[model samples]
Structures are given as structure tokens and as C-alpha cells.
Target: MNVCGLDRWLRILVGIILVGLAAAGAIGVWGWIGLIPLLTGLFRWCPLYAIFGFQTCGLAEQKYGS
Candidate 1:
């Protein structure tokens, strides 16, 4: 998994807040975009991280090697 720890948590939090706001009609349809982060955080795999060769999960480093 490319996402983990604080980064992952933050994504989940932001996603929840955005989606929640959208649901409450506080923001708008744009809040729906929060789903991207929500799914990425939930899945623990980020496509952008893969493309950019970035990894925050230390477990991934040890398991997969540098």
C-alpha cells in the first residue's frame, strides 16, 4: 500500500468531512470529489503515488524493498 499512517488518516478525515458536507448541502457537488481520497485511503493504494513513485508506508518499503 502506498498510503498509510497520518497521510491515510488525513485523507479519510477530509473525505468524510467533504462528503458529509455535501450530503448536508453545505458545499455542493464538488464535495463529491472527496470520494477519490476516501477510496484511496480506504484501499491504501493511490494511483498518483504509483505514477510518481512515492510511498509513505514503511511496511511497503520493507516488504517490497527500495
Candidate 2:
């Protein structure tokens, strides 16, 4: 749950737009990269974030009872 709130929503939105463009043959294969953000947003976890020790979800600890 490192990804949360607005950041998560933006990732989902951008991912959808990019993938949609790819499917429509508008952005070509590059748009396929959008799947990265889409999956991260869906899972609420980002590998890069983990490596960088970054977290956007403030409620993560409380939610998990940590």
C-alpha cells in the first residue's frame, strides 16, 4: 500500500490512457509501458518506491495495525 490517494489515481488514469492509446494504435508499442503504472496502481506497491524507501500512503501502518 505504498501507493495511495491522488498518486494512485493519477497512475491509473495515465496508465489507462496510455494503454488505450496503444490498443488504438495511436502511441504504438511504447504505450504498452503503461502497464507498469497500471499494475503498480492496482497493487498499491511500487518496486522503485520500495528501493528508494518512498511511501505515499500515510494510513498504511494504521490500516495494517503495524
Candidate 3:
């Protein structure tokens, strides 16, 4: 995964919680932004990481498929 195990699970958990809170009207509409982490976790890719040459996949050559 582009993100490490801990990071991936945290993102997914936080994303779901935020979205749930938004849907329940307990938070602002800005909570919808949680989708960023949700999708990135599901897809195992982060655009910011790709752009910044960062990765937590535990492999030196994992970034950009280099």
C-alpha cells in the first residue's frame, strides 16, 4: 500500500467517522472533505505523496513505480 498499515487504517476510520458525523448533521458541511482520505485509503494511493516523492509502502522503489 502507498500508505503504511497504521496510516491506512487511521485514514479510513477517521474518514468514515467524519462522514458519518456530517450525515447526521452533527458537523459542518466541510466534513465532506473527509472523502479525500476515504478514497485514498480505499485506492491505496495519495496524490500528495506522489507529488512530494513521499511514500510509506516500505519499499525504496515503490514510489512512482520507479
Model 3, range 2-60, lDDT digits (tens) per residue?
Answer: 77566777889889999999988899898998898988877778999889977667765
Whole-model alpha-carbon lDDT for candidate 2: 0.88
Clashing pairs in 2: none
- Across residues 1-66, which tens digit of lDDT does each residue of candidate 1 receive? 898888888999999999999999999999999999999988888999999999788975548733
User: On a 0 to 100 scale, what is the lDDT of residue 18 in model 1?
Assistant: 95
lDDT of 1 at 64: 73
Model 1: residues with Cα > 4 Å off, grouped in runs: 60-66
Alpha carbon deviation, residue 41, candidate 1 (Å): 0.5
Q: TM-score of every model?
A: 0.87, 0.89, 0.83
Please give the lDDT score for candidate 1: 0.89
lDDT of 2 by residue, 1-66 (tens): 688878888999999999999999998999999999999988889999999999888875439723
RMSD per candidate (Å) reads 3.3, 2.6, 3.8
Off by over 4 Å in 3: 60-66
Q: How do the candidates rank by lDDT, highest first?
A: 1, 2, 3
Q: Once superposed on the true structure, which residue ranges of model 2 sit more than 4 Å away at CA?
A: 60-66
Per-residue error for 65 in candidate 1, Å, reads 15
Model 2: how far residue 30 lies from native, Å: 0.4
Clashes of each: 0, 0, 0
Residue 29 deviation, candidate 3, in Å? 0.6
Candidates 1 and 3, the one with greater lDDT? 1
